[model samples]
Target: MKNKDPKANFGIELDESIQIDGVSATATKFGESFRGIFRWQQSFFKLVWKQAIIYYIIYVSITLFYSFALDSGNQANFDAITSYLARYTSSLPVVLLLGFFTSTALNRWFSIMASMPGTNRPIALYVASLKEDAADGCARVDLYIRYVLLMWLLTFRIVCKPLRKRYPSLMSIQAAGFLRDHERLLLEKHKEQPGGSSKTFPLVVYDWLNILLRDTCQKGYFSVANDFGRNIDAIQVLKKGGGNVIKFASKNVPVALIQAVTLAIYCYGVVSVLSHQIEKHYLTSVLSGYFPLPYALPFFFYYAWLKVGRIAIDPFGSDEDDIDILNIFDCHINGAMRLRNCYGVKITIPSTDRSAFSLS
Candidate 1:
């Protein structure tokens, strides 16, 4: 069967400078975590490998030729090459071990955050709304943190354990619940505020602040919408959301196929190059020149995938899926009326012309 091109299938371009205001605090936290992961030292190894691969190949080829031409007469050269190869081979295991430990540390940190209280509630309400808003916020925060940590864990498991790939779906339920609860809470809070308050003098300044905050906060809601939308797309493509759909097809089918094929090809190239050195009895060649490609490809592919996946899911970003800021403002305005024990239902949308819009 012909393989698919992952890049073409999943490629999505995004505007780099778009601002998102109404995003949920939890979603923002996930974005921050992802950024942190990218900036880690482990992430930089990929870049190093890319630059070193070609030089490594050339070194390996030269080493093999020298060893064979010397016919075991040069014991010093042979010992030197053997020692170098051993050292190089040993480095891989060390790196892998370090990566494993680092991932464990990160997982523990995430778990601690998830288990902590009140990630969702405003700092002001923590002491008063402990049971309702505060408690719910904490649960939501925990779930959100857990969901992000689950993604990181899945990445580690796929790259390291291999056997734990079966657990990806287990985390999705909590992620979805956390996202839903976050949106609902924000919406409810927005709805409960007054349309206008006596805290401001001219009333115009208060109206503008309400509008600005509403717009800014809606970015959080948009993030939730994008997350849900992407999952839905993935589900459609996989046919079964939880399983490994090796044969699945959809709008994203081309992208998935392409990615798999590219990865296979990259793997094949590295193996082919390495096998050539092995057959020629060129141990030094394998150690010196061909070592970096195997390490580089995975890292490059991962980074590319992250950028493309984000683009695919959030093309319009905060502008498209964002919460209705104006609607929230209207809700807050209407709700504030209840505070004064006024049973009137006539909430007005302030106009540019003061005489035109008035609430009795």
Candidate 2:
């Protein structure tokens, strides 16, 4: 048998990004925690290895510069500066800031993911309202589902760089079957309006979706339209979630806090190596200045921790650590398209009594 794409199990197509799912699905034993430690995709090592290498290179260059380049007089001044930095670095609260920021980012990221609007609710609403839909209802269902998904893409395109890659322009999305040609002409007209459109054209898609939905609903084609309030609720959730993502990523993370933490980590590393220069003084400790092991630990920890926060804030980005937005889109496309394919109700059960049936 041919090997299947792992994501197909989730009813999604190949996302062409990273896949971290199913790595530990069967690792139920206590010792199995390490099952995915070495996997290149979505590994912590994968996320931070490039930065780690650059850090070590810079640290080593600074170390060599200190040990060999400086004259005795300049070396003494350098030592003084490093000592001063090392002394005050203790007050920076690097750990506290990192811990708080990372925890908060992680919590918000989870919320964004949970609140990501999926078509499941809309699909359920369709099923509830029109189990035996008319032909016109089916056409409306097709249009409604497409519009819902288009709205998601429109909003996500505001924040998600990857989705923009898939649908670079609203015209591209339209050509790909997401919008009607008339809708395309309407968007174009909107784009040419007073003051010219925003550099980002997709922002108008929200307004378009709003107008499209209102007009479509006005015809009263839906048999039982009350359930559609549920779809509206889902759209509200999507917009709110998108707004949170934008606000948290761009505005929530305090710039000063980040700068302080970054300076602390880098400054600590450079000063730490110089301060512990055992070769210059009488050395006793096995791990001294030349042995970067001491500084390496904290540097790696803080740097990697900060990167986790960076990836957490923009979960829709191109990074391997980003959440799979395409999966949700696929669920909408493949599953929601079957909204009008419902069959007659099947309520039959076995006629045999439970007591009469043999356990064997």
Candidate 3:
């Protein structure tokens, strides 16, 4: 995150050049909310006001131009025409369209959030259902759980920008104890091979888990038929969740729908403000002369809602308003480690053919 204070800043402030003023908090820390409308750093104000400024300027200019040019009688006639237009144009259809579009965008956001695996629940189940009490059995089970946790984190790392930032590269991931050095080297090697497009890393983790499960079953860890089936089912649940995340991440909200919504909002904003200005010219003329900021309130609200909906439609980006993906992964990792450590199990990869599972 970048600081907004001029004293802490080195470069020219673009907003200053534009003559758009804002009250920036010099000492506001991460996760602190600057939420109220009075605070210039509020998301609604920051996102909405910049665009609203343009329309406001247009409204004031138009009002002033008319006020000076028109006589009292002609001004009344012009107001009548605009009032008539307002009656037809400022109807409920615009609101209905905005409502539907915003609802759809919100649904898309929740859908992506819901697609993530409930890793803690599945992890608790795995820990509770461990049939083997022996040291080697516990270690193998811990290793498998660690792989599952790693796979989930890797899935998020690919789709979520915040997690990608935290684990910038394979080396960072290796340093974080999620990937062994050999594993990172192997992934890097696969990445260097250049004939075809690279496969996503989560799928590689998925394949490795499947191989681990089969091998462990063969080695008599999950010896009982019911236990093996149940364990496999748990793994499948995790795999399905990961698949859902990947599917959603690869796809995007329909562009046509987004454009339609955006077009409607801005166009309606223009129409609504224009109509209001003409219909209430006498009141607006006075306000424009005495206090210009009051004229911008309705538009500020309208633009803010539209801007909020647009931001909500895609919540996986690196913006401050986005979903906290890095913290979620950190929680999952901590939970997995705690569960494994409680059973005194060491979670190291076995020295088998580890080269085959490559994330690169």
Candidate 4:
């Protein structure tokens, strides 16, 4: 439904209705960039394997130490060892939970920072610069926590059958269609407004659409349902928000919390299973060899599955994804420069050939 008052800029208020095909150009651009970052099969696999190896090493060292403590029969040592292992197990999920949160938050922060007119630097440069800012220590810590939470959620969801079942193609198309329609309406309204600069209108519309697309299609309740066909009741709430912005803000926090709890539970179960397996095989000939292999298996498999799933679901980050970030940035920059020129503001391009180049 479109709002009657054209002046309501506090929230998304469509002034006209227009049906458009596919995603808006701005969305397509961002999507492409996202895919490029995440979609490279070799890079994705490397990251997965690297994480798996690190986890495997840690698991092996801890399991060996516990096994030795058990063999020694020192009550104090055994109790201390068990307690440490338990703590480690309990913390695994928390680490994962934190990774996911941190990643999403960092991504959001960078996205916002990158969008600012004055900060026209590349994405990687922005991230590097942020990392170097000692004054932003608190912000960095917050981002780190969010990243850990994001990783945990991503790992847990990849392993859970119910979560995997939620993803689907039809929903993505439908969501894309809805976004395109509203974006077109907003663009037409901008065009119709009196005294609206023709050049300014397109850039504003592009920025508006960029923000709206992130809200609707990026992640959260609506994206989950739209991307996966999950029969979640949250879709109703999202629709009620009038636009996706409210829905994104309201749903993301709860979702993050639930994911953190779920990861904690999953980690507890894994630890319990591992502990039992170790106890059963302790002081036996099989203990020397059998324990280490099985101990490493679960963590290795879990991490591998996580990396693969991220590759699949977020293929937009890959080279094969439909969107291209370089082109989108180029387009936006060009549009902004054009608008500046229209306003008689002098600006210079370093080089036409280099201007549209991809970071990769």
Which candidate number would show the highest lDDT if scored against the true structure? 3
Worst 10 residues of 3 by lDDT: 1-10
lDDT-superior candidate, 3 or 4: 3
1 against 2, candidate with superior TM-score: 2
* TM-score for each of the candidates: 0.23, 0.74, 0.70, 0.29
Listed per candidate, the RMSD to the true structure in angstroms reads 21.2, 5.3, 12.9, 22.1
Model 3 segments more than 4 A misplaced = 1-47, 68-88, 131-138, 188-199, 223-225, 276-284, 288-298, 344-360
After superposition, candidate 2 runs with Cα above 4 Å error: 1-30, 36-40, 54-86, 131-135, 194-252, 279-290, 343-360
* lDDT by residue for model 1 (54-93), tens: 6466546655565565665564555565555544442333
Can you rank all candidates by lDDT, best first?
A: 3, 2, 4, 1
Clashing residue pairs found in predicted model 2: none
Instruction: Provide backbone clash counts, one per model.
Output: 26, 0, 0, 36
Question: Model 2, range 18-98, lDDT digits (tens) per residue?
Answer: 345647656679866677776777666776678667766766676678667988888788777767766765666678878
Weakest 10 consecutive residues of candidate 2 by summed lDDT: 1-10
lDDT of each: 0.33, 0.63, 0.63, 0.37
Error of 1 at 40 (Å): 14
For candidate 3, write residues 1-360 as lDDT tens digits.
Answer: 111132321222111222323433442865334423365543566786567667777777767766788888987876776577567664636567667777877887778767667565555555655554544767675667667877787777667777777778877777766678887776667667764112456666667777876776666655465665676777778777777877776776678877776776676666655555443457755775434465456556666777777777667776656775655555555566556655535478777776677775
Q: For candidate 4, lDDT tens digit of each residue in 106-212?
A: 45433422322211121112122222323443343233222222222222222223322332222331242212455445545776888653333324433432343
